[model samples]
Target: MGRMKPQTLLLQSKKKKGPTRIISVTTIVFGSLILLLFVLSLFTTYRYWSQRSRNLSGNNDLEDFDEDGEKFDRPVYAILDTSKGSIVVELFKEASPEIMDKFFHLCKTGYFKGMLFHRVVKNFMAQAGNSQRVEAAEDWMLDMKPQNELMSTKHEAFMLGTSKDIHANKGFDLFITTAPIPDLNDKLVVFGQVIKGEDVVQEIEEVDTDKLYRPKSPIGIVNISLRRQR
Candidate 1:
C-alpha cells in the first residue's frame, strides 16, 4: 500500500502539470500575436507620415494642383540664348513684381552670360549657374531683399523660378521647369514663363545628362537679353 500511495501521488502531480503547461503555451501565443499587431501598427503610421513628408518637401513626383492662377499679359520678355537655341520668357509684372525686380537686376547685369546649365532633374527642372566664380561672380543675389511669401504665381512648364532648392547655396541663379511643378509653388518664386522657343526649352530638357544631371556636353547660356514686347 505504501508503494501504491507513492505511485498515486506521482500520477496526480503529472496531471496537474498538464494544465499548467497548456496555460503557459496559450499565454505565449497570445503575447506573440500582440507583438505582431504592435509592429504592424507602427509600420502603417510610418508609411503615412513618410508620404506626407515627401509631399510637403516637394521631393517626390506625385502631382496634384488645385489652381495655377490666371494668365497675365505683360510688355516685357527675356531672351535666353543658349548653346542649344534661343528661348523667350515673358515677364508678367502684375503676377510677380518682387520676383521680376530680382530677375531684371540679374538679367540686366549679365548674370547668366556663359553660365552652365549645371544640373537637370528629369521631369522636374534644369538649373543654370556659374559652376565657379568666373562667369557670374558678383554674388549680388545674396544681398537681395526677401522673396514675397504671399505671391500667388504658380510654377508651370517653361516657367523660370528663383529657387535653387533648399539644399543649394546659389539663389543667384535660376531654374526652368519641364513640366507643371505645383509642388514648388510655395518653395519657388516664378518670375517669367516661356512665351516662345518652347521647342528650345524641350530640347534642353532632353539633352543627355550624367547621373547628377549635368549635360554630357556643356549647354551654356550664350546670353540673356531682356526687351519690351508689343
Candidate 2:
C-alpha cells in the first residue's frame, strides 16, 4: 500500500477510538451498579439484625413481667388482731426475703400470740413482736432474735421497721409505721407495709402511753394470722 492520506489515517483512528470509549464507559457503569447493589445488600442485612435484636429484647421484658406477676399474685399477708383493731400487712418477699420468711415462720408457730405492742410512738410507729412477755415462754425470746441483714428498701408510710440492735439480738421485734419515715431508711429495714386498716394503726398510736411510750393499759396483739392469696 502507498503512504496513507491524513484523512484516511484520521478516519481509522476515530474508528478504533469509538469502540474503546464505549467499552470503557460500559465497564465503569457496570462496576458502579455492582458497588451500589453491595451497599444496598449491606444496609438491608444491618436493618434485619437490628430489628431482630429489638424484638428479642421486647420478648425478654414480657417474660420478666410474667415472672413478677406470678409472685405478686400469691403474696403473703399478715392479719394482726389487736386490742385497738385489726390491721392487714402485705409482706414483700422480694424486698426483704429473709426477714419476711422469719416473720411468716414466727406467725405460723404462734410466736406472736398474745404479744404486746411494747413500744408505741405517736405519728411514728408501733413496735411489737417481743415474745419476752409470753407467760409460757422458755427460750422463745432467743429464738425471736432478728436477722438484721440490710436489704434494699424505702421508708414509706405504713411500712414495718427493723434496726441493727433488733437484728443483733435476733429479736422478733417488728414495728408498723404510722407515717412516712424516710430519715430511718439507712438505719432500718422496712420489709412490709400495711395494706388494710391503716386507720387502726393511727388509733393504736393515739392510745394511752406513759413516760416510756408504752401503752398504759394493754395494747395486746391477740394473734397474727398468716394468709396466702392470689
Candidate 3:
C-alpha cells in the first residue's frame, strides 16, 4: 500500500463514476418514457372530446327539426328541371304531410316528367303535374276530374272538398306561387316553397300564355329530383 499503481488509480476512478453514470442514464430513460405516455394520454383525451363534441352538434341539429311531435332529422328538397330553368324547393313535411307524401311518390314514379307547366298566371303561380290530362288533350280543361279517383273509392271520398282541408279535390298538381296569395292559404296545400331559382319561376310566368293562362310554348318538366340536406 506504499504507492498505488497508475492503472489501479484509473480503475478506482472508473469504479467511482460507474454508479453515477448508471443512475443518470436510468433517470433519463424513465423520464422519457413518462413524458411519452403523458403526451399519448393528452392526444387520446383530445380525440375523445373532439368526437363527442361532433356527435353532440349533430344531435342538436336533428333536435332543431323536431316539431309537432314529428322528427324531421334532415330536410327534403324538390329540384324541378323545367324547360325554362331549374328550381329548388324545400318541402315542409310537417306542414303538409299528406301532400308531401303524394308529391314524393309521384316524383319517384316519374309522374311529373315531360309534363308541361300547363297553367301559368302572371304574378300569381305556375302549375304542373297534370300529365294524364295534359298529354291526353291539347286543349285540356283546367278543372279536370281527379286522377286519384280511379285508384280507390276511399281516396276519392277523402278528396272531396271540405272547408277545413286545403288540398281537398286537388290531384298531384304542384303549384309554385310567384306572389303571396292569402286567399289560397286555406284553399290550397303548399307542400314546398322556392328556395333557389325564383328567377326561373319568373321566367316561366313571363312566357306568353293563351287566354286560359296556359303557356303558349311548352315549358315541360324534364326531370325531378329529391335531395336531402347535408
lDDT of 1 by residue, 46-129 (tens): 999998886553332212311134333436667889998988887655555545655555665667788888876566677787
The order by descending TM-score is 2, 1, 3
Greater lDDT among 1 and 2 belongs to 2
Task: Estimate the lDDT of model 3.
Answer: 0.61
| Regions of candidate 2 where Cα sits further than 4 Å from its true position | 1-73, 131-153
TM-score for candidate 2, residues paired by index: 0.56
The C-alpha RMSD of each candidate to the native structure, in angstroms, is 18.6, 16.7, 11.1
| Least well predicted 10-residue stretch by lDDT in candidate 3 | 153-162
Model 3 misplaced stretches (Cα beyond 4 Å): 1-71, 131-170
Tens-place lDDT digits, model 2, residues 115-145: 8887676766777866353321122223333
lDDT head-to-head 2 vs 3, winner: 2
Lowest summed lDDT window (length 10), candidate 2? 59-68
Q: Candidate 3's residue-wise lDDT over 109-198, tens digit each?
A: 678788788877775566775534433222222433444334322121112111222244355666666654434443445556677887
TM-score of each: 0.54, 0.56, 0.53
- Sum up the clashes in candidate 1: 0
Q: Measure candidate 2: CA RMSD.
A: 16.7
Error of 3 at 92 (Å): 1.3
